[model samples]
Target: MKNRNYIHLFANCLITKGISRSVICDLQRSKYVLIPNSFADLFSKQRYYNLKEAPRIFDQENLSIFHEYVAVLKDHNFIFSCSKKELKRFPQLQLKFEYPAKITNAIIDFDKNSNTTIKDIIQYFLIPYNCRHIQIRCFEDMDSIFFDTLITEINHCFIKSVEFIIKDSFEQDYTQIMKWVENNRKIKSLVLHSSQENKVIQKENYGFGIVVTTRQKITSESHCGIIHPDYFNITIESYTESLCYNSCLNRKISIDKSGNIKNCPSMKQSFGNIKSIKTLDSIIENPDFNKYWTISKDKIETCMYCEFRYICIDCRAYLETPENIYSKPQKCGYDPFTNKWKWDYESFTK
Candidate 1:
């Protein structure tokens, strides 16, 4: 496919970092569209009042009450930021991320133990909700019997698509995994994490109908359709960054581990919290939280003139705090804002 073929508009914002309904409402008035984690129930009971008109609606001591009012606005699936007091009003809300209904499939890296358990919790909770797809993390060294048992259990559960991470250094034979996938047509996608040799496998063996490479080393030439560390900018020298090109092309919901959710994993700040209001509907109705998704990258001054803006992954993590996200993510090689590299300009030019 062509470079622009994979262009995607991402709804950037995390509910956990604190964005309020009023703020989101203000943003919506400015013409921004949002994609919230929860659906709509979390904010249904609340009413809206102008900050100037209802100056005393909430006491200074109980700011959380005000937060609840704004959070209710967020149920509309908009994006905005709120405060601690506002977030407190929704005590049931936790610090988590939720995807929109349209996005039924997701691949989460179980980087932490909590992440692993979180997957199970999601599976249990979303089953009744009729979620269609899920791909869980699995270590390669685990026993084949364990994989078989896991596959059997997953097959028994309410799932349409399932994928297991194939690590590069795993001792298990890929043939076995491929065999299981072949038998289980329920699996629609397969991802290889940090696999250099497996890059060759996609071309040699046609067993995997759809294969994607999650780490950096594998490229488009390998026919491993997807690539990760997507939070960086792209250039001709780094063509592999386009791996997410077709995959996320028309995607509406985007997720990142940044504590604060905003457009792009590299951005700073957030719209609201997902756990505070456990349902996706709660996030859909909030007017205040809707603007982030609607705003185009071209409107944002920094991105408008950059040569790589259209192809590069705009990240909230780096924008939130450059030092913490990446010391040297690929796109960081040159800064459009300053027109200089963090290192020597001559070296980058050469």
Candidate 2:
């Protein structure tokens, strides 16, 4: 044999298995590729690679199939061939996940008759916590004065990124709303639901992303967990965290339209009324609050066997069996056993 070497997968290309297939998550590039279960078996040996042992992975008839998968893997830069000595120099990526803040993100919903004002909310919650991300869902058209005040006050808060979910306005030119989001440095997305038309707008600075969903009104948290591939998060932090912790509820807080704080706005339980809750610190410390934080995909039924578990966010509040804490997500329509993704009208709860 010539310069024989071992084969190695890059530290970031993590593979996860389902019952019938596998998902290759490219953490560095924020993408994922699905592969057959048989293709994943090529790595089961987990040893040095050489021409002599090629037969160990494939017989004469299956050699072409092995070559096909190898080609696909190489094309995506998921694997590399190295000398035997070089193998010892490479180490697998550490799979630990940790967030510096007590609460990492938040979702605050507002309706036409919300009890509190946006200014008070900023001063009370956003200013006190070091939350990195937030989602503001306005169920109805908002007052121009309050909207302007929120934009100005948000600049002084700890939220690094935000997404605004609002109903499209017919009273005012929606383009003007888009302009505000475009100029704001922290606003990542502006989703306009219940619109006349469906479109996605991304122009220059302030118009980074303005999504329109026709005939769809996201009035509450019940609209979550749609389970679309477009919503998957392939980041290293999200992937590793999904391995051990609940992706949706971990270090997350939500405040519904009625000012009731919860792990998710759709859930029945509330920590306290935002107006009366002394400190979020007390609520986060309560054992009843963090109970769902650790219920990861590995512990969830059906999802435990899916190859896309780590990349797909989990919804603890809405499940196939509400009585069972480990029930499968009702919004998920993927059939991992059949190696296909399909939406079943009867299966989707909301």
The sequence of per-residue lDDT tens digits that candidate 2 reaches over residues 1-350 is 43545567788898898899898889999987788877776665662345456677678878877677777878998888887767777677889997787788889898878887666766666556667688888877877676676667676666677788888774436667667776677787777787777766554355345544455766666777677677789999999999899989999888899999899998999989988974788888899899899999999999999998999888888888999989998888888888676785335544
The lDDT of model 1 is: 0.38
- In candidate 1, position 135 carries an lDDT of 54
Q: After superposition, how far is residue 309 of candidate 1 from its true place, in Å?
A: 5.8
Give me the candidate number with maximum lDDT. Answer: 2
The all-Cα superposition gives candidate 1 an RMSD in Å to the true structure of 19.5
The per-residue C-alpha lDDT of model 2 at residue 201 equals 58
Report the error of model 1 at residue 161, Å: 3.9
User: Candidate 1 residues 1-350, lDDT tens each?
Assistant: 22221111112211111111111222112222222323222333432123442335546644555456445545544433443344334332221323444334443333222213333435543454565666555333335555565567666776666666644444335675566666766666566666554343333234334555544332211122121224333332112222222112212222233212222322334444333334434333444333333333344344444333334444322232354321223334445545444554234334
